[model samples]
Target: MQGLVQSVFDKLLPPACPTYTGLLPLITTLLQDRSCFRAALSKGLGLGIVAAAGLIKLPQIVSIVTSRSSAGLSKTTFLVETFGHTYNLAAHVRQGYPPSTYGDFAALLVQNYVLLVLIYAYSGQPALGVSIVVGAVSLLGGMCNSGFPLGLLQTLTAGNVVLVFASRLPQALANYRAGSTGTLSAVTCVGMWLGATARIFTTLTEVDDPSILAGYVAAAVLNGIIAGQVLYYRGIKSRRGTQPSPAKKVQ
Candidate 1:
């Protein structure tokens, strides 16, 4: 019985895993090892964020599909986002970090591509969509290939701080100007903020890569801005809806 229990935990929390590993120490120490415990918790939360990333954008996708319109959606926003995420994903994979540390980049890249295609196709520019996707894939894919330079990847990843700001700024500005978050899913915006914030902790605890850390910090702040816009607009919309309209003129 003891051997079976140890064997299961060994597989579950292998030493190669970038977190608190052995179950016996965790149990015998009564969780008194603060650093180890924090690492374990961070790892768990990182994995949770990764799992949520897989579906985090579905709400926005559904909103656009149901409305049959990509109104208020920014093509530049998604395009730049794809560009940033692709680089981030490539950098992380090449850096050999555990997937838990940067899994959101992969998931978000796919979601952003879908959004770009949908926005283009619905806007009557399917050819442009195909072109952009192919072009981006070819260009970014080639850069990430073998013989690619790590120094360049590091520079690009560091630049993601700027890219993250650019990606979120337009959407937030659009919401401010329109006084509405049209077809933007509150779920997706809020999820982005939460995920970005969580990544900050996980990055600190796990990888501690400066470029990745800076990017997540910027992402958290910027995503918060967009999420705040969503909430503020929603409140305004609700209040307006509740306000009594002027009594209809008596016939």
Candidate 2:
């Protein structure tokens, strides 16, 4: 049944290129029998939904780079995300598992790295200094494991989530209240939303760790809120555009 579902998802969204090729045989095998098709389709649909969510972050990413400003970008969220992924990596390492299993580690690494660069480009020394401090702490936590050290590492990991969510809440609320995303890039917002959605499904379908699942869910909700704000702002802008401006009185 699982195999059948995977096959359908493969057919609809179709894994990107080289990756999908490897699964092609498994997918084909399931399709050969009619009885398994429905189950396969169900699984495929779930995967598709996740895939759609993953695409949401693309818009936000593009917007930040193109505009060269972190205007609406929240440093705290990225900081928390970076720390969270770092902790996850440490946990995987401690358990003798590969880090890639978490998926978000790679995405977070890229997102946080690029964000730091963008922050530095616009905000300069202070931002860079903060990034350095956070990165240093994250690095130490991931590498060292001694008596009390292990406990400290675990704390850092847990703390990352708290800091990120706490930091993001205000910005999210501000965007929602203002009904304007301001300098926040539309591309990045969309991409982040999709990525977050995908991450949620990825947790549901792929990951097993309860802690990781919790983190992903938290991130997903935050991303969804941000996406909602951007979409709402766009709707308002569109409506205003359609409405005619009041006529000026004759001099």
Q: Which predicted model would earn the best TM-score?
A: 1
lDDT of 2 by residue, 121-173 (tens): 67665567466657756584545454335556556555544654875686797
CA lDDT of every candidate: 0.83, 0.59
Best by lDDT: 1
Off by over 4 Å in 1: 1-25, 28-30
Q: Write the per-residue lDDT of candidate 1 for residues 1-251, one digit (tens) a residue.
A: 76777666554442433333356665644367566567667878988998999999999999999999999887878988898888787888887877888788878877877888899999999889988888877866776686788788889987878998788889888888998888889999999999999998888888857888898899999899888988888899999999998998888
Error of 1 at 119 (Å): 0.6
Question: What TM value does model 1 have?
Answer: 0.89
* Model 1 per-residue lDDT at 55: 100
